[model samples]
Target: MALPPRQSCVDHEEISLGEIKIKTKDPACMCEVEVAPQHCSVDIKSVVIPIYLKFVDVRCSIRFKTSTLCRGSSNIVGKEILHGVSGAVGPGQILAMMGPSGSGKTTLLSLLAGRSQTNLHSGSITYNDMGYTKALKRRMGFVTQDDVLFMHLTVKETLRYAALLRLPKKLSRQEKIQRADSIILELGLDKCKDTIIGGPFERGVSGGERKRVCIGQEILIDPSIIFLDEPTSGLDSTTALRILQLLHGLAQAGRTVITTIHQPSSRLYHMFDNLLLLSNGHAIFFGRGQDALPYFSSIGLNASLLMNPADFLLDLANGNISDTSIPPELEIKLIQSKGDSKVGKPPELAVQEYLVECFSSEVAFRDSSVDSPPHAKDVILPPRREWSIGWWQQFLVLMSRGFKERRHEYLSWLRVFQVLVSAVVAGLVWLHSSADSEKHLQDQVGLIFFISIYWAYFPIFVAIYTFPQERAMIAKERASDMYRLSSYFMSRTLGDLPLNLVLPLVFLLITYFMAHLKLTVGAFLLTVLSLFLIVIAAEGLGLFIGAVMMDTKHATTLASILLLIFMLTGGFFTHGLASFVKWIKYVSYTFYAFRLLIKVQYSRSQVYDCLSATGCKSIASARVMADVDLNEAGPMEDVFALLLMVVGYRILAYVALKRMNTAR
Candidate 1:
């Protein structure tokens, strides 16, 4: 692609500032959502930002001491999404980052939120006292485009999860609940406190409601600074305005709220007290929103459209340099403005403070006279206590949702049902011929094939479905440091168990008896082992797919192809063929697993010892395997290898997941 052009500045005549007058209609209004451009205007004679230390406390200030490359600077030539853009936002103010859809607005938000810390080709970011990205991250909370919520959880549970995971134990339980409840009410989600924030499949609340819950979850953390990336992206204009209004309130209460928005409605356009305009990953304007037009006019860049100036800025940001020309005076204006040190507060605090002030202006809101702690009410609950509940708690939750999500569709269920039916058919076909040594081999092969199909295919299927859903939550939570990735992996793995165990175990047990595949107790135990291996391996497999492919359909496809390759290459299906593709058999997880488990079925080693010690017995009465031949190679070695395979692949899967890191 061609590069952004470096054009001469428009070199416009500077207008005298003595005639400029400030508008003052609504003194109470600042950057509130409802504030109009006409309601509040600053005098042109002085800087809107005066150097203030308090501003340093609330806004994470990013500054480049040297002059920055503007929209068409000759020194700037790269495809970087976010250029050396510097701006500031403090407590109780709104700094709406306005740019086109892809002008690195979200990218800049991500950086400010400390979600990602890749060093800029140049610049410095300071949050509170910390200069590095790491320190800034700890004090900041970020909300992304995707709301990472557990659909199975109620609003209360979701908030509770975040609280427990985020806040240190020093905080009292009451405080956490109060904190959570406050966020719920603050976000205007009190009415849906018990509702589930559902997804496309799990119908519950509206998209806007779910989006609010996401913001609420982050709010519960009560960070010193909160950064939201496109906080109002997907909602309707009214809903979006309401959400922004809620954020404005949050800012007024001494919280810092920095968010990115694109082509906002005219009403939303004027809501920003401070605007950071970016084009081509470069800053064009970084000051009051209304000043945008004058900045353009000063640059001699034409912007006659009645639409939001953000749109005009965005077009200039993403458009071809050849078609666009930067006015000379605009560059000088941007360069001059770059030196202003103080940035304003987050607008969220203003709204929040306004509400607090409105309600408590007359009464002592903080005094005990306002309201005492309410008395606790008795309630009957489940007999099972929370302490004793182990992974089983998660297991039940995951299993219930998995079944509900999968069971409703004929298309989904058919895949599961077909496997079960195939198992039954195989059992009936192989049952009558499996007492002799050759028959024993056939029986072993039957079990291996059936088990391989289940283990190989099921994990891929689950991975395909579960990864996309989990990714949203994982990425969001990971960015927040809600929990360690290992913790999440453990919980999710444990949670999916009860459901995963049932299918493979049920099919194998029923089929085993019907096929009469060496009914030794040892074989039965191995059957359980086989199930465990498959399920765990399958989980690992699914994780690999999910981590590598963000798109579920693509992940599913990749997983399926991998499964086919591994299963076909498994020695059980075509043992002699392995000479040509022997490496394949070695790598095939199913091959090793099924071979190991099937050997146990065929050998009945434990049963053989018992029978031999008794000097054997009549075949009919003893029901011992006649082919417990000493000449046969034992399945013990194969079984151990399979067990190792499970461990090996599981570790590999975890490594893949870690490598496919999230924004953090």
Candidate 2:
């Protein structure tokens, strides 16, 4: 095997402007090649496929619907956010979008990254001068503003799963693992590779390492274009500088890197190849980073030599020119532009309008020395493969990940202790109740009702928090085209089933034997089966509620109201309900479960002692069940009803997740 030419062997042109040195790579030798260590030999392709991203006349506006009470109708009010912003970034360069908060930096980045835009937006965003296609989705990567990761997954585990799911299926599993190991080495994450990525409560990797892990996940596929939203946010100056250097290295490897930056230090500003300055959703300047200072000075806005260039640019965008030394002509130009916008606007608004006009009027800036981007018809895109893995493969991988991440939470000592303590207390309260007398029979009824309601209550609350807690993580993964939504949904559902059953099964075993509900094997199995069905049905309903609400507090509130209603109509609390509410029992799965338990324990031929106005007499169990309305449904009928609920609620939850994915 032959190694590619080294970086020193490639021809390069250097230009000096003031204190900044700009290095331009030769177009004929643009491909980037990497040499591996002695033990490992995989290398980046010698010929790179480049992506040129260009957007023209981009505009975005949001509509706010305001109600007019007097007219009994609503009016649509529109506010323009991004106004005709335009720029272009090509291979082997970093384009940095900089502005203060709410200046449309993140919004423009989202649009370019192909995220969902619910508002009215118009723009021509092209790659290689071509429109977006589904194939392009997997070819690009997006890192969100916030780090979305499994808190329990070690750094190596996170990257390994990403490699398994994102890498091409043609590669063997061992090869994919090796790729992950290489990324860990490249990112200098070897020290903390085994450490878990912790959250608010747990101690884990530092902030810089977490951000690097997020980047590693995206780059696992070697994306042609990568979009990052505030990747340097919440980090110290030194760490942020290192991150910028890493991005620069990626650009040098022939990847198109575009990122949103809020406020950068002086040292960080010079690292950018191109800069897009925005204010109030309007572009103030679009040109090379080094040329910005010269362009501003030419327009008679001069900054102090000691002042940070980033701060100076930010002040100009913010319409704060108190520290800036403006020439007489520029001051006059600001006054002349006052009447072009609103009549009685503030001085700051006037200055911003003047700057917007200044950039728009610069023809030389619009037609720089850069060559025109190639047309789509002239460029040949590589053949894109289908999803790296099949649906079942995705399900298995996701299931494995979910189990590894959630086992600790599911089998925690606190939860185990809680279940055990509750089981013991309930068993002692109704210990060894015989079915011979009416009082004992009533005690048995209470035990059966407790089994039905207690099991339902435990899982419903727990599962309601599932989707709400993982909404961000799910969205992030789905956006990356890592796997189908169905794969994730199924894996999430099945991964939890076994772990979720442990405590419940233990609770039932302890209570059933201690309370002496049934001695026969068939009866014991039936009781356990009934509780399992109840758990599945209840968990499905909880998932549905969480998916619909996607907020912890709201989902919990709705689940509480819904479960309370179901329990009330579960054939135990109320018998003489109004006709309108009588039909609720048919829909409440808990009602079916309770009926199944009653049928399992008490047979139709069983008799109980009763007393009414005379000596004690015998009463048939069938008559008692009839009075309570539990005898209407057969045991098999109850099982089918519960099974139907288990399927129906799960379907609803999945549909909800699909809608959310589509919305994004």
Candidate 3:
């Protein structure tokens, strides 16, 4: 006889039958103990800093300015979302907040997580009796409803990078990798460890697996409190249960977990240690999961055995209650209150108000218990430390991660094809033209101007997507204090540099030789140098645009307008313009870049012969340059101007990012 097939690595049992030939770790038993993280110097007692969270009368309101055409005036409108909601949960407890759509579940969660920017009318949110601080961020982990992940990175790569940037410097790289592997095994992700975390566009891990990856990343640093906004929002029942089960394990390990859930099955519902039922931004019930039904029953609301308690609660919250469940007193009160102004409210609002009153009157005392002083052991505040990795280390790690995440987008077949096509077309259009001819020399200048404008146009569109696409992920990581903004900004700029240069370099190599514009090494090198500056300067402008307007659509529009303006004043289109706008040419990066290109290829000594009225008269390069106004500035002057744009735009971008972070 053979032993039953092993189910999971953590929990299993031996079969009744005599096992076939197999040697277990302990030849007598067939079960394996759960694997622990392999991070160095990790003492569970010291690391598991349990957080006892409590919030009192947490209320949030938002204000917006509106214009009224009738009055022809502006008005300030305020709407209260979360109205005096309160709850508490301690270590080793799973507090599940359930409510229907627009019931303020997420709003409450955001306020508790300290991520909300709305006005708090009155509330006190504390952990271990201490207020939220920057240091506390390191001890908390937040998993938003949507899985924000690098779609191209494998599970192992994603988790390992999280560990590398998030884990303490005390842990070696190998130890960090081992820790990631441990989490992979613990979360039962070993099978898909090498699979890419897919997005809507790609096929890879399943939804359950992706959620587990998010959990794994948050837990890599052993956060004391984990806040999840509907971790199981969009998954199937089985997959959702698996995520909750994983979260249950975290609670069992003495970590506090709070999550917002929409609806759960009986089995999933029972797993919650504490339940917070909300309806219309009001707290209806806050107590043990088992006590919720009892409390509802005691309040004259009962569900049939065949009905799910969650369903019944939702029905009550939704004002879909049956006549049998309506208590005589509530019904009588409803009748007597009909003449009252409150009767004009929606049925759900009335019902929600009734539940709020019932819960508050009977169990308002429970809030006192949650507000009681916490134990001294729970007062531990994680020691605030600088970046777990040094500044340079963070830059390297971020750059490496950025490179891996974006390599596919940068080197996609379509992009390579586009570059190749553009190069081939340009090469064929000006194939083997003689430099001594005036017409060919003029064509070469036009070609140089085309190069400048093409590089500028292409890079701006490409760079606009960078910040917008990663905004959510960056916000999440920054909220957790994973890395500095400077490190991330530098890494993004530098990591893109090498790959961004690839297409331009390849284009120049192919187009320069085919066009036969200049044969000298110095001329070719200068051509490359000037084109490279244009690319860099354009990229910096794109970064600035992306940072300023973290909306890809808006950024693209603004970039188009700005680039068009630069092209018009680029000195190639027109030499004369209005005084007010003529200064734009001096400031336009493309203008300088175009000037440098012309300066590098043509010199005062060079002359081109053209068949004219005087029969093959020689025209000096100086006169040719004067025709287009390229001779106004020397090569060094244009280089200096481009250098300034290159550095200045990036600085502005960095500042914009910093301001955006602060705004958040």
Candidate 4:
């Protein structure tokens, strides 16, 4: 057999397959030849192998500490989440996990998918009999219950971005787009591929379509194993059935699929080849789905003629059969007999223990074809896979997506209207003031100070919500090894710059000429630049608050407090503070921005007339600067200070976000 043609080491170079050597005279073409039996062989054509993941005696337990502070004393306790639950999922098979609400179904799934790291995990999870590691994680996909998608993006755009971030770099841009299109068609989202995935305020695709788009995103990598948590929770019966059918097709095409389902219909239940039933974190049944009915029957439990098998199992697991429509006398006898078997034990507890014992005796032995424990030498853990794209590519893709999302979600015409209205109101309040009158000077000072406060307050409030909203999405993507944290942070910061600049600039343009304080082109441009910088600084501060706090309401409150502090020390409300508290003014961005605006407007002007009757004397711009305490720092120095604050706050925000994601 002959191997497929490989890329030449150089133009017109000869390659020998048997010898695993390439002959080339060009020193630049120093490519080395390597052969592997599964991918490429010197004597045979390319061979492909499918991956199947299996776990044996897998157990996970989470220890959480709860503290109560009463009378200045603390108490703590710990608990386990999952017991020794074990099962296997192979190629072309679907494993459906069914359990009551708090039975650790999602916890077990998280353990298998490596999504939770703050747990005590034991036993073995293997891919093709090799130990599971980061390399294998790259080939597996996990879909969360909630659809954490960019709500502003179309289905096609979302999948395309996923492809760009996840697909191998060897694939060209066009190839990646084609892959995304294929997945869109496969998931039946072609009908709404171009529609936005709307959120609470926007009306876009249906719930079913959004769920399909979520699945389609994970499918871009062509993963060998896919795990989903409650994929059918919100959809109607028909849509639920369709999603299961889609998973069935994927399994048929040689992918292992697993999902946790709640109260699935009988038709949907039968689609699963295997079922792992749990109660109180104990695996009660782990075998073929068809075997569940017969196993229960052998244990003296029979399903009603028309009862759905799923409902029967769920009722049996939950110990709720006595609450059903059985006859009163029969129900009493059933309850009496169940109580007699276990005296003081709860029915659910008794049933769980009995089922676990039976499953161990009957099913474990039959499935123990593999040895009880394999030697360390027998378990081959693959090396971690390299990232699909480099950092530059990741940054570009993230920045582009951020820009598009912000344009659709945040930068609306309504925001423009609000800014215009505020600008017009400010203009009307201080319309056409002159430099000669003392009252005009006071109004001009008030206007500049208000401008600083308004830009600072508005941008900070808006930007504070960014991290709280996207933290889940960021955590998910990071777990999948999609991109670097720095790339995402930089992209988001840069993406917001356009809107931040535009909104503040518009406000300045409307109010700058309307107030008639600074007539020179130089002064007007300087004022606009100063306002833009202040807005950017405020936005950076907001990002820091959002990232550090990670809760919208709490972050908002903290941001309001901090902004209040900055506003008080902003050189307008108070000219001098106690010596001990004067340092706060130095730290406040608003103080610097306000001083810069004041200096830009008055530093070069000479007062020709005075309207105040007390003194009534002409004064230079120097006297005006001394009156406002803007002489401490030059305009350039204040500008530099604001720039430093922006950079410093953004870096802190990035660090906080990185810590939060890794803390789990």
Best by lDDT: 2
Instruction: Report the Cα lDDT for candidate 2.
Output: 0.81
**TM-score for each prediction?**
0.66, 0.89, 0.90, 0.87
- Select the stronger candidate by TM-score from 3 and 4: 3
| lDDT (Cα, tens digit) per residue for candidate 3, span 1-664 | 1223343322222222111111222212221123334211213212556578989888888888999999989999988988888889988899999988988999888888888865546788878788876677777899999999999999999999999998877778898898999999999999999999988888999999999999999999888899999998889999998999999999988789999998898789999999999888888899999999889889887765468788887877776666337677677666655657754755555666788899899986355565433232234444553567888989999999999989999899999999999998999998886656677677777888888889888887898888888998889888877888888999999999898878899999999899987899989988887888889899999999999999998999999999899899888877767889998888898888887887787765555664555445333433346534433545888889999999999999989888885333
Evaluate all candidate structures by whole-model CA lDDT and list the values in order.
Answer: 0.57, 0.81, 0.80, 0.76
Model 4 / residue 271 / CA error / Å:
1.0
Model 1, poorest ten-residue lDDT window? 49-58
Alpha carbon lDDT of residue 165, candidate 4? 96
Q: What does candidate 1's lDDT look like per residue over 1-664, in tens digits?
A: 1112213112231222222111212233121122234332222211121111111111122333343557543343334565456666666668888766666777667665656545443454444323433433334567887676666667876776566565544456566677777778777788888877666777777778888887887666444467788878888999888888878876766567788887688778877777876654556566677877675555455655465566666665554223334555444434444544364433322322322232233221121211211110111122321221234433343344445443333134665587688778877776644544433445545555776677767666765556576676667766665556565565555556666666677677767788776667887887787767666676777776676676888987787787788878765555456366667767766766665554565543322222344563222222222212322567666566666765665566567678766734
Indicate whether candidate 1 or candidate 4 has the larger lDDT. Answer: 4
Clashes of 2: 0
- Write down the RMSD of all candidates, one decimal each: 17.5, 6.4, 8.7, 6.6
Model 1 TM-score relative to the real fold: 0.66
The clash count of every prediction, one per candidate, is 29, 0, 0, 0
lDDT by residue for model 2 over 286-322, one digit each (tens)?
A: 8889988998888888875569899999999998888
Instruction: Name the weakest run of 10 consecutive residues (lDDT summed) in model 2.
Output: 15-24
**Model 4 bad stretches (over 4 Å):** 1-49, 323-344, 365-382, 608-633, 662-664
> Which segments of model 3 are wrong by more than 4 Å?
1-46, 119-121, 322-324, 333-343, 365-379, 382-385, 610-624, 627-634, 661-664
